[model samples]
Target: MLTILAAIAPNFLLILLGWLLRARHVLDGPFWLQTEKLTYFVLFPALLVTNLAEARLDGLPVAAILGAHGLGITLVLGLLVLPLRFLSPRLRADGPAFTSVLQGAVRPNTYVGFAIAAAIWGPHGVTVTALASSLVIPLVNLYCVTALIRWGSGGGKRGLGATVLAIAKNPLILACVIGAALNVSGIGLPPIVGPLLKILAQASLALGLLCVGAGLEFSALRGAHGPVAAVLGLKLAVMPLAVGALAWSFGLTGTTLAVTVTYAALPVAANAYILARQLGGDHALTAAIITASTMAAAVSLPVVTLLIGYLP
Candidate 1:
């Protein structure tokens, strides 16, 4: 237990450090925002490409893992969607707030997932995570975009074709596809390029965690307790338990099971608030869900690790 906690402690500590930095105003808002953009557009993609390009992919159960993970997320989405039909008229009438609930229920923070996977399972874990991200990212984006468009106030203004195109051009997805291609082709990276990518990849972990910290906003939770609590329960508790069961049933074990569960247990993505704001959803509620889920994960994740340790 101590060993598992020891592994995850530093990653969360980095997040805490980021929160401290932001709280102290050591770095201004624009700096953190730009840092997030750089990390997302450049550093993270470099990490994915370098890791995936070098990964030994011969024997991994790529299909089964993707299938099981996708199924798990789909089930969660279905469960969350069902409740919307039964919500109070007042709650149901609030399109933005409902959209916030939906986003919180489904989005997983891959930045934190990467940091945790690398810390717990090393390179092989990262390889599996990258692969999982390739499949999961597009799937979640499709669903979230659909929900935003269907239920958000200005969602109708955004064309489906444009949303699809934007997702297609997402840097992270592009990185995964290109890296997987390189892995399969066996062309690998040039010697000079590999070292440069390595440096960017290393920079991503700390910076990414810090950005995640800086993005946290707890003040929004006050007025939105009910919905926020529900989202947090679904995101941090229900989703991981459900996904872990599915992974086990699919015969995943060791690092594969561990990484998948960790990924599932991640908080709502920071980008959820952005999407909510863009589409006229309840951005405040979305931000609160992100903050609450992230804080909850510090405890939930270690408990999850301990549970995985006891699994056969």
Candidate 2:
């Protein structure tokens, strides 16, 4: 237990520091906003690219791990669409709200997942996490955008082509693609290039966590309704359990299993609100879901760590 706490504590501490800094006005809102932008567009991508490019891929259960995530995500999507989406009277009455719920249920904060993986499993774990991100980032974004456009009161104006284009430009997906390509090609990282991305990757987690802490919206969850509660269940609870089960069936265990479950268990991506606002989904609820899931994760992550340890 002490070891577990020690592994996880620094990541949460950085988040707390970010919140405190934001609350105290040590840095203005715009500064953090730009910081997030830099992390998203720059540092985070560098980290993903570096890990994927350099990771030892020879012995990994790449296909099984991918299948587990793909199936897990599809299972969650089915649950969201058939029962809650089509059958629930409350969600039917509020399309934008439903989209927010769907987005919250599917997206994950990679920053948190990456931080935890590095803390618990080191570089090898980060490599596996990045490998999972290769698929999850694009798949989740595509699903979220599709849902928003279909159901959002203000979305779908640009049509499906535009949606494809948007996902194409996503830095995370691009980074994954580039890194995977380099790894497969066997060219490997060049001298200067390797060092540059390593430096950027080192800065990614701390800055990203700070941004996450700064963005917490405690008040948004105050009157949080059915959607928020449902999302909490889906993102934090159901997703991990489902993923862990399916992953074991698919032969993932130990580090791979834990990292995949962590990915599934992470809070909604911090940037989900941006997509919600732009696409006319319920951005407020999205914010609320992000904050609530993040708070929920502090407990849920530890539980997951302990539980996975008990696994053979």
Model 1 weakest 10-residue run by lDDT: 81-90
Q: What is the model-wide C-alpha lDDT for candidate 1?
A: 0.84
> Which tens-of-lDDT digit does each residue in 52-117 have in candidate 1?
788777888777678777998899878765477367464577877888887888788888888888
Q: Tell me the spans in candidate 2 whose CA falls farther than 4 Å from its real position.
A: none
Q: Rate the local accuracy (lDDT) of all candidates.
A: 0.84, 0.88
Please tell me which predicted candidate would have the highest lDDT against the true structure.
Answer: 2
Q: In terms of TM-score, which candidate is strongest?
A: 2
RMSD (Å) of each candidate, 1 decimal: 1.5, 1.1
